[model samples]
Target: MASDTDFYSILGVSRDAGKDEIQRAYRKLAREYHPDVNKDPAAEERFKQISEAYDVLRDPKQRERYDAFGPDFRRVPPDMDPADYARARAGAERRTSSRGDPWGGGTGTWEEWPEGVRFSSGSAEGIDLDDLLGGIFGGRGRRGGPIPGSDQEVEIELSVEDAYHGGSRSLTVEGAGGTRTLNVKIPPGVVNGQRIRLGGQGAQGLGGGAAGDLYLIVRIADHPRYRLDGRDIHVDLPLAAWEGALGASVEITTPGGPATVKVPKGTSTGRQLRLRGRGLPNPKGRPGDLYADVKLMVPHRLTREEERLFEELAGTSKFDPRRRR
Candidate 1:
């Protein structure tokens, strides 16, 4: 019953959490609420629930099957009959004891049993013990059969530009056996550690089980021009001395494209310019804002004529950089 808890919710992790993330969350919670340390009335139940969730999620095969069929999978009807099932299981043990083939030996092998021991069906005339034994001793059928292949994990790195505008990328995954090329679609505004699931791309299932999924974890590379905070984008824009002294409209680059931003006249080095709806897109279809911090740049090496102009301007004006400080 404890295993019936939703694996994702029980682990306090998202459905797309990576293996290490899930393991870490489980370990943290397990340590905090372990029954041995917490003697509350409900401690044992909570601990069992946490352990159950980890048990299935921690195993690749079991997790794949659980993900494919959900929590009710264990209740699915088994393929074998009750009587035959018991006999077949017992035969497996006996065979193992005698060092014979435990899994019903290949197609047409006769099972050797003791002489004169007749297991009778209650009707009337005793049934041939050998026939009953043969039917029960049928080769050990596949146990648990083949399950859908385990899910695979791959990490992908993206540039900030790519993350701003949705794009497609080609990636190669190297596994124990070989490599596979996958074309992945990167959605706009995909943040670091977000995962994309590719269904039916995992290991091949045993028997008729469906294939597992392939998960791609996104990693966004740092950009020298901009810094990100949630959906907002921040950038420090350089302004000419005149532009900082007098208000001006300047062109700036944004993830969406280039835009003209109005800089208030007399704006200081730390003045902020805001462009709305230019940031990352939110889940509710709203976009974040872009913030520009204006920084003034002074030109070096003035010409003789420029020196005279500055001399006259300085005599007429009373501007000083250290006045505030």
Candidate 2:
């Protein structure tokens, strides 16, 4: 019931091929015969033929009309019955065979038509090969070409400590296609709003096109102690009043680990001590710095001995309280 030039036959799909199966077949053939990829002179024309077949078969409406009316479906009236059209075409073929016209002078089969009859829509009394070829190819210049897949972006949240140390993380993404889990690698010193590209992991392309890339935008989580500003980390360093008055080596917690910093003898509140390369680790550049902001704390209640010492110092010291510098 099918000919070599039939849309389904051209695309190498059966009459009952599903949409996915048809697409797969078309993609396979397109990759082999696409003009851009294939340099053979005959390949261009072959590609056009396959592209035309795919264009019509890919659409449900077009495919339905094509299945009902064959290659002349476009010329057949929408309201016309399939049986009536078949009867009319058979009568026309018989007339053409008797006249012995230039259209191969035989049965009006698809192969008997001109070598390249681009199917298009228009009014026609009967099957005119030249008219049909010119009408279809000239009307809408649509063809099946490889369309590059679209890039997809997703946001991933990471803790400050996780960001500090580069490691592998398991991420599950829920989308219209359902849920899929991926093992993502987190780079050290990745700042907020940074994007990590995963090649060939985006939306699938059509007509054997290249798959797009997937971008993972990093969002750093807020930490209780550490404040992130780019790669630099800021943390409040609480010290006793005595520690501020006299320099001492105090231990502090960093995203990396614990580190000891020396406080100056005249250290005051709001003073920051800089620690080089103690912040987040940089995978591809210089590491970040850490700032320890000093905050002096005084005991709400002190023992009698501590109060006496404080009073003695207040009485003996020449440093006037609240004196203008």
Candidate 3:
């Protein structure tokens, strides 16, 4: 029978929680009960229990079945055959003890006990100090040292334009052995701090295990004229004084290409112009919008003839800049 502790209750989250929510809850609890950090005797056991719960709940199909059938739904019936029970018990003991070789073959040496008695292979044998110490803590054997390899991490910075348009880039990474050029593909509309995983590109695994994965974290560079909010791209467009008053078609650069936008007459400095379907791409493969904020630019240095024309125009025109305020 399953224990009384509810998996959802232990994680302090609802059973219907999503994968991200469950992962967040598990991370919180793992950090709190981690054996290395907590230094309590029960912390390892609690962490193991939480890991088991996460393993089941993180999978969508498993979570669905578990939710529908309850915790004991997969348990073996009490009237099972003796051989089946023995096999189940052996499997459980193997997982719990970690005494024998992980592989099926038993070629590894085993500690010798008294002539008449024998415990598990890695268990305490006779009255040896090392065996006694191993049982007290986890049953960790002084096997061969870890395979010689080093893990590495790299961060790449991209402009908002690059993020909007997917492209290939070549980066040079310096490692312990030497520098290597890695050709990477930057996906369109990738957000800042997003990670791309490259399998088998990290440190080589020890004892023929699979290699770790390399994570590439994306960081968007700050733009002087543009700001990004979700899939929307915002830019401050500086316009000439006459352009705002007269209203003209102006060309602007977009991620797709240069396109001309129509400016309405009497446009204010804070007026916003939206270009539909010209922003970043969303997860559902749809494009967003681009917003342009108009700013009027007045000339500081005017020729003598231009100044005389402006003075004459100002006398005839009744324009007050602060009339609205």
Candidate 4:
């Protein structure tokens, strides 16, 4: 049957999508639109829709019923023909509209039947058809069951050095309840957008339900000297003109510690010197490489002796830098 509130469309998944694909889509959207992370007023309502869609589509039985009966699957019988039900419901709606009560509050109709009355033809023993049909036509009241606490998302920024080495740090969070202090342990080699889950750290649940989890979204702060691409590190290597002409070993600073790189002879500007396994440390997988970009530097002011030496070389030397190769 056609449905207005399509759970598959809400989660951005096809009707034939697997459970893992559905879960991945839900997690990605949940991280983006969770109320604690996104401040847009409409995001909260969108989040509710996403959560509701995920909740219903995750269960096999509910998904089957929803696929067959649409949004009112909970109230419709398993064996009922959806097309006939739809036509009957539309007729009831038109009849109610003709009675001048557009909202189905008119008297003397099955839509507004008295309590405990069996409106159906067959015997539905001990079942209140009035309440059942009333709920189907959008006449249900608020539920009084225990509600689980809401899952929350927060950003945690880290320096490149801090991200290289795992450590413990204090985090202060401010929400509707008040300000709270927490000690968070950052894992090593955490890349951007990685989430660290802390169980039972979100808002408290109502009616004795379990509290939700708190997810820390990792954000790596920009560095003055280092640039990160995946686990690889990039840094500028400034060298004197002589150092570029003649090979020299120079010390460079890395997130791990100080390291030395060999500048090859005849090296020019823009040359990248790779130092293997010197980038970010990965505990579980292969580590990354470090790349140093070569830049030739000249002294701002030349000494009188340096000027005389340059003049002599210019006068006698056959080498011409501007000559075409």
Candidate 4 Cα misplacement greater than 4 A, ranges: 1-145, 312-325
lDDT (CA) per prediction = 0.67, 0.71, 0.64, 0.73
Which residue pairs in model 2 clash with each other? 120-136
Best by TM-score: 4
Across residues 1-325, which tens digit of lDDT does each residue of candidate 4 receive?
1234788998999998889999999989877876656879988667767866886788898798887667766445444566655654665565445444433333433443322222332223423433444433333212323334666668898999999997998998766678899999998887655567788888765445456667787778889999887688999999998899888999999999999999999888999999999988888788889999999997899999988977897899797778998
List, residue by residue over 1-325, the lDDT tens digit for candidate 1.
4545688898999877888999999879876775445668886567667766786787886686667556733422234344444555565456445443333333323334322223332332333433443334232213334334556667798877887886899999876547888788888886544556787776555455566667786667779998776567888989987887788889998888998889987888887799998887665578778999888987788899988987898999987878885
Candidate 2 local lDDT, residue 38: 77
Q: What's the residue-level lDDT of 314 in candidate 2?
A: 88
Better of 1 and 3 by lDDT: 1
Compose the digit string of candidate 3's lDDT tens values, residues 205-237. 444434444667666777876677656788888
Residue 320 alpha-carbon offset, candidate 4, angstroms: 5.2
TM-score of each: 0.56, 0.56, 0.55, 0.58
Superposed model 2: Cα runs more than 4 Å off: 1-145
Better of 3 and 4 by lDDT: 4
Candidate 3 global CA lDDT score: 0.64
Clashes of each: 4, 1, 0, 0
The TM-score of candidate 1 is 0.56
